[model samples]
Target: MNRPRSTCLAVALVATILFQPGARAQVTGAQVRDAIADAVRHLKARQQPDGSWRSRDRYEHGYTCLATLALLLAGEAPTSPPMARALNVIAHAPDEYTYVVSLKIMALAQADPEKYKEDIERSARWLMRAQDESGLWSYQLNPVNYDHSNSQFALLGLNAAAQAGVKVPAGVWQAARRRVLTTQNSDGGWSYTFRGSSYGSMTAAGVSDLLILGGAVVSPVERGVRNGVAPGCGRYREDKPLLNGLRWLGREFSAIQNPGHGRSNLHYWLYAVERCGILSGLQMLGRHDWYREGAAKLVSDQRADGGWGTIENTCFSIMFLAKGRKPLLVQKLQWSADDDWNPDRNDLEHLLDRIGDKLGEPMSWQSVPFDAPLERWLAAPLLYMQGHKFPEWTPNQREKVRQYVEQGGTLFLEACCGREDFRNGAEAFLAETFPLTPLHELDSGHPVYHAYQDVAPAGLMGVDVGCRTSIIYSPFDLSCHWEQANIPLLGERAFDLGLNIAAFATGRRPLRDRLDLVKVAEREDINEPPPPGDPLVLAQVEYHGDWQPDPHALAHFAEYLNEQAGLRVAASARATRLTPEELPRAPFLYMTGHYAFELSGKERAALAAHLRRGGFLFADACCGRREFDASFRAMLRQVAPQGELRRLEPTHPIFSGSPGFRIESVGYRAAALAENPNLSRPELWGLETDGRLAVVYSPYGLGCGLDGHACYNCRGILEADARRMATNVVLYALTR
Candidate 1:
């Protein structure tokens, strides 16, 4: 009902002033109407209990003048009852109200015609009386009483009135512009009711008004205008009064950058950034996607009330809540022909059939359609957020996924939908664990793009397209906008690569798919037990989930497991194998050629128990049983959340010696490795809070699927990935 708190003061470019007259105005006729509406609400409230205004209430002068300026701003001539009542109220106020009232008279002039011109002339004359020879408006004619806050508002009212076509004296405008600009702070923000310190509200008021007024100022009046682009005085090296103003306006309390800065309670910055459409301006400045992440932060901070409000913090909080009204789903879906994408039952059936073949099996290749009839179209590699559930899995896929984890394979997904809901369906299908695991903002610093830059579109693509990709280039499409759904073929160099997205979300302690952080002890205590700890039992068994292993591979796995765990299970015992009871005693099992079937019945139970009992099981398929990943997954589900296992990395103490072996050296070798790869796809694995592996695969495996497979030869994975795998196993087993 009242003005939304602070009545007047413009942000950035809004404060541009005109000395001679209107030059280039940012405040359009329509925008002025909106601003006026805001000002009037507050002015009307300031019409005191005494049929007059009181200077004690800063609201009185600021809003009254703001209302007048808003009306003048739009040339909305007002002589009607509302205008006359406003005028009468101004007349009843004291001398302290003179500076503000002058603008009021200026506004009243627009509505009164020549027939009633006397009022207009009289109003301008009264305004002249408010200014002193010093060229600045003052409180009770006292300069000290009138600081940056009051003075800036008064001059803005003056500028607004002048721009409204009123014949403001040339000298009055020039003097006022100078007075205001000089008071701005180095930070480009304003302090409490004045100069120096920068407050979000004032920064908005001052900067907006300055840009607006300056935009309207005749060129000569701005001959010495400081866009704040020089090193004269300001935070940035550039003279960016206007830019800095906007920056301050958006920079309330949120340190939207570093992970440590800006808590959820930081409300002001979010408020300013959202309402200011700062992103739009930044785009104009060529900083693409600059505000996308900020927009996300606001969305994440929304309150349960669907509104952001904190007592008096309501104005900004509400603005923030309203900033990102909805996820910026590219192709912003509306209920139209494309709503369902299509409606012919035959077409739907065809798509369904294609999906069946593309995925081969229903459960294995996930596509969960939400129960809501409205969501029938989200069928491809869709995604559902944590809040939702995946469609139920068939009994077979369930076991299949379970074994896949045991075998150490990750499920990668790329998803996007409009008014449609794919993630909703995805939730129903992948009911393994981490229904809500989300994608973190992938910075340029991430190595995904480096993994295969031109070969595949590898960037940290956010789940929401509009938020991630600012400008989609496409010479192929009719228009320039590159629509992902339309470009069926891999367009020149395009593919939403989410290799780690899936591995990061699922995997058993996958060695090569994620953050392979291994502390390198450049200097180890040579006198003490060696890191390799007496050769560190460098034994490894390469398990390719594609095919079952021969007895030799099994023997390698068993012997390596026995040695790493310090168990004396002889290679001769390979025929019957030691039971689960004998397996836990071994501290480690560093073998590859992963296959749940090769694992004896006792081995599987012992492996699960071993994990629970802090046993380490490093499984890296050496390309033997490529398809048995399902088998591995099926087996591990029986132990913990299938999503828990992740790939290990080059740094997992295994690479502590070399400190560089990763996916590039090896290959993406589960079922089959990628060709002409940009990087290697080796993974490291770990457990979560419940002792379930935190990683099914490495989320930060640098170049896992890019270059040649590091696991191409039996010697490669064992010599490279195997060493790290061994170290992790030995350490985990001993620690556990």
Candidate 2:
């Protein structure tokens, strides 16, 4: 077989360049999801009356187990009709072959481990009994012919079983780990048996087996690095056989075809690649984004019927997409060239594992370079950086970090080992990156301390960007404790603090992958300048306080108006003061801030005169800050002393659908709902002048939501509702 040299170049190019904003415009998260949905419909249609998807004769049970596992991983509920029927079939099916039994165990364990505990234990024991002295499995027990493929499935089943509370002896994992290490060829790849040429499928299988056996939960030995000797740390390390296998696979990686075996068992190879990537906590292996490249291939290869090929192939494809597409919760940043930035290499993986177990959902994380594109950084809501020393960054990289935070990404800075150098550098970096926003020490009562796990008095400092605290800095070592999961109370505290930060940053919301937020060509129109036909110039009022908390809010709202209301708004909003000269240039004025400031008497008189002249002003307290709220109310009273600022009832025309969809009720952020559980109605106050509502106000935040960013602790309306409300307010300002 002639290996293609271009494959290496393709992977390198994807790694280095394709992560830019609009590089891979054709492939998007939504498109991948739609393809998966289409494949799911195809699978549903292919289900037989017996709930088993038909395959080759006598392999029906194995295929059924595979299909059921795929569907379960694909977000299908166990109570769904097809899944229920499949489960029933799996329960009664005779487990004669090793493959079928392993697959059945996997499916049952995934469906409901507690409920299927007994069945999983039975299958796990069967697998243990079937293991040969060499720690490999074959088609049958005590078989003469053992293969890596069967061993891989057996390990997968046992791992799942172990996760579901079934006890498998440590010796079994040790023996398996030893066998794979010894079997690795000098070329760093694995063959079918111990003699054939190395191929992609077996190499992937080998890598995945090592990952499972050396997993944080399953490894029997201590997790350390020590010359790769006997009884060494079973966890993955730099100089390990696992890395060697990964290197081999990476050298020959191909998403479209199984290397050394063209177009055969392709989906199976892809599935193994997903397992390897996810288990290793790696986003790129030898310059290849295994998930991205493979997902694009599978999506394009999906047939009209949605099946990749045979029943087995389709099952593998589904599993690859479903499990691989799991959103990333955090991206550990590689800030420096050396290991200082990652003293505790597995810190994030261990932290995410604990968080996932606590939340009862799987979470994913990866490490990307600091210079990776803004789009890549935005893949996860949180970007984590830690080091013992100050890491250097270019001007462009510093700007990218700021852009990431501005684009709804949170920056988490930690001083590893409580290093003073790192802490000083972090503070300086924040100061430089956000010169206008100063860091403030978070009190014990801050939500970061209690967002999920209460770790009160946890010393943390933060910087508020836009409507949220976008920068969280810890001037102490937490990753070290996270790496040492066996540390007494310290480990638990570290995990708790880490989980709290994640929850506070993400609001426990479902995250999106990089592809999900890729800028497509169709959205380019939003940034294009509006045609010169009396375009509405949305104006933001500048003031003494932090008036422009969210710089993009007005522009995004303008885009929203253009898209939703067919209004021709200028591409950019104009920032102006409350001078008479500037007030008349735009009829609609938006003002929001996070601090308190009183308008000058002259400016107040100009604003009041503008309102009296039929100009409309919309103001909200950014992030629902009380300071801004109180000051705005006082300013309103001063500006319109005679006109009472009364609450607009649900019966008001604005809520009654005069301008946009009737919003009798709107969704508020979790923080808002926590404060006021019964807050379903729009909370707005209006002041009328000359029998027309000239000024509208909201104590809650609208700017952050209008900017289309996640503000976890913002006591404000949800994004969708905020945009809708802004739409209604804009229409009201224009028409009324």
Candidate 3:
């Protein structure tokens, strides 16, 4: 009761309980796929004129057979030409065939039993004839002594025969069991004929054989494979010999032998782990990182052809890569909706680089964030970065933008706080120069919100935030340099308006396409040293390396624009670095740390006039903000009455967008996402204007309050405010 059965029972118990919920799966499915791929490569390499591994007189038939079996287990269709050829060669091979072809063929036939019925039947007969009267088939048909490899192969083959309904001679099983017992050394281990090499691989195989054939507990074979005997058992001396075998196999596999190699055998070793089900045994052996190391090696061994070769190297390489698939294909995110604060920026590359550093393991597949339009953010989020400006558009850019807009586009613009001296600085466009469409706040109940719902903040912030990747805001904004009067402000108006424009324009296209056409709008507050669209002061961002736009990539270029280029209105949407389908619906989309569309054409002049027209503006930190706000103010001039954008009150209509007036945004004095449920609706909460003066305005969480203007309680929160603020803005745009 307390013997061999316990160990076998343990193996069974582990298998059963190991798959429970949260019980991390073993050797992920991908590893298996890769291992199978490796087997295919090996078989492919072995293919000869007959479509099998046989070099005219080379006599590597056994190796070829082994390779075929491995590939067959990989789902290589037997009817397939390569397999058919291999089978043909095997049929014509010399006599005395014995490499467990029957067992290997089992997997091949299982895929389509009828097609390989004759093959299986023939193999069964071959095995029966190959078996000796003593029940065991040793190496090359005859053996002097009994022990691990040879004995286990016979049992394994016979076991397969039994499973397939192939008949074996009477008393065969009983005799094999007895033969195993006789070979058992005093210590519970069994020695090879003369006791040579002992190792884990051999021991594992032995354990499998005993379990498959003995059908008894505490069988001498069980101890022989598992822990080895204490010393004295019976007269066989098999115990020491078996332990020695395991030692040999273990050292053999573990020994880092790179013998002047163009490629190491590590890959094959990994393949063998899976092929031999060593992964299961390793787990039981408590080798936690064993599989991971194997995976790492696999990654290093990949060839240009995307396939593996050799039974020893390529096998492990493919299996290891496949095993690590779960983690590799995991696709991580930097900012989850559940975060305490929402970040604003348009730099996707920065986020990618950060996460890439943390991945530890390299990813083999292509993954992107947000499969939908870029403008569907939950809030009218802002994108802010420092220093660099976009490169001048190529000859095709104007056409692209024109085409993009005619289809439907909404781009917003604004002045920076640091450059607020210029009048009508952040207008949609310079009415005096480039007269493009003047961007007014979009009309209330516009299609932007209605794309998914008719109301504001329909899905909590409503719909989805569309911020597929992590976002960041600028550390230094507010740089007013307009010849006209400039106001100090981080134009939330511009950001929101831009969102509507982009959504209306590019929603039909993809985020990637839209990113291709956008040009950073010149801040109306800043009169450029040169003309806007200066080729000398521009950059480019693209996925493939061929184009190498002057701006380089999004993360680098956008950050440069935000920090060094003194860019006020930036348009940054990074595809490879960030995934954007995570946030709630908003008018404008922000990235790692930048905004899109500063201001161009008539929009710039309109903004200038709008400010002079006493229009109000709101801004705030979406995520961590002290630096972002500081940078934003640096770009403002008289643009904002005060060089600041503070919170508003519950009475603000922007808060009216959703049911709950509460502003539980990502960043705030405290967070309200917890207590607030009805967060999606429409209400007017910010500034209600009659086009007179900027005297009456509230800076709720949406942001307001500065110099001469003071918002009550720094934009007090209400029961239902975000929706109201949204409604208020729509109404403002409609009337203004």
| Best candidate, TM-score | 2
Top lDDT prediction, candidate number:
2
Clashes of 1: 158
TM-score of each candidate?
0.27, 0.86, 0.36
* Better-scoring candidate (lDDT), 1 or 3: 1
Q: Give me candidate 3's TM-score against the actual structure.
A: 0.36
Across residues 1-736, which tens digit of lDDT does each residue of candidate 3 receive?
1111111222222222221122222333444455557556655865677665543233356555554555555456777888777666655455353544543444434444555555655665665555565555554545443445555655555555454555655466666655655554443333344353323334445444445543432232111111211112111112323233233333333313321222344444344333323312222122123344454445444565545444434433433344333222111111122210111111122222223322233211111111112221111122221121222334453343232222222222222221222123322112322232232333354444433224332111111011111111111221111101111232332223323322332222222211112233222111124236632222111112211111112322333335443443233332221112211111122111122212233433433344444433333322223443343343233334333333455544334433323333422222223334443332121322343323222222332111111111222233123223433343333344
Error of 3 at 568 (Å): 18
All candidates: CA RMSD (Å): 23.4, 6.0, 24.3
Each model's C-alpha lDDT?
A: 0.35, 0.78, 0.33
Model 1: per-residue lDDT, tens digit, 196-228?
Answer: 456654454455445434432411111111221
Name the regions of candidate 2 deviating beyond 4 angstroms.
1-25, 44-51, 55-60, 79-85, 92-95, 185-187, 215-237, 357-361, 518-534, 579-585, 605-614, 633-646, 649-652, 669-677, 688-692, 709-715
Residue 47, candidate 3: C-alpha displacement in angstroms: 1.6
What's each prediction's clash count?
158, 0, 214
Model 2 lDDT tens row, 1-736:
1110001111111232222222332467887788778878888888999798776766658888998998898889998989999999998877677889989999998899888889888888889989999988888888897889999999888888888888888778878877887888888799888878888999999988877765432332334222211122212234356656877876788888999888888999999988887776677766577787888888888888888778788889989988987778888886765555565666776788788745436778877766666667777878998877877677887877887777677899988767778888889888898998899899987878888877867788999887778999988778767665666676688789999998887776666655665331112122244458879988888888798877778877877888888888886787778898878886888999988889999899999999999899998988899999989899989999999889998888778779787998888887788898999888998999989999889989988788877676688888899988888888888776
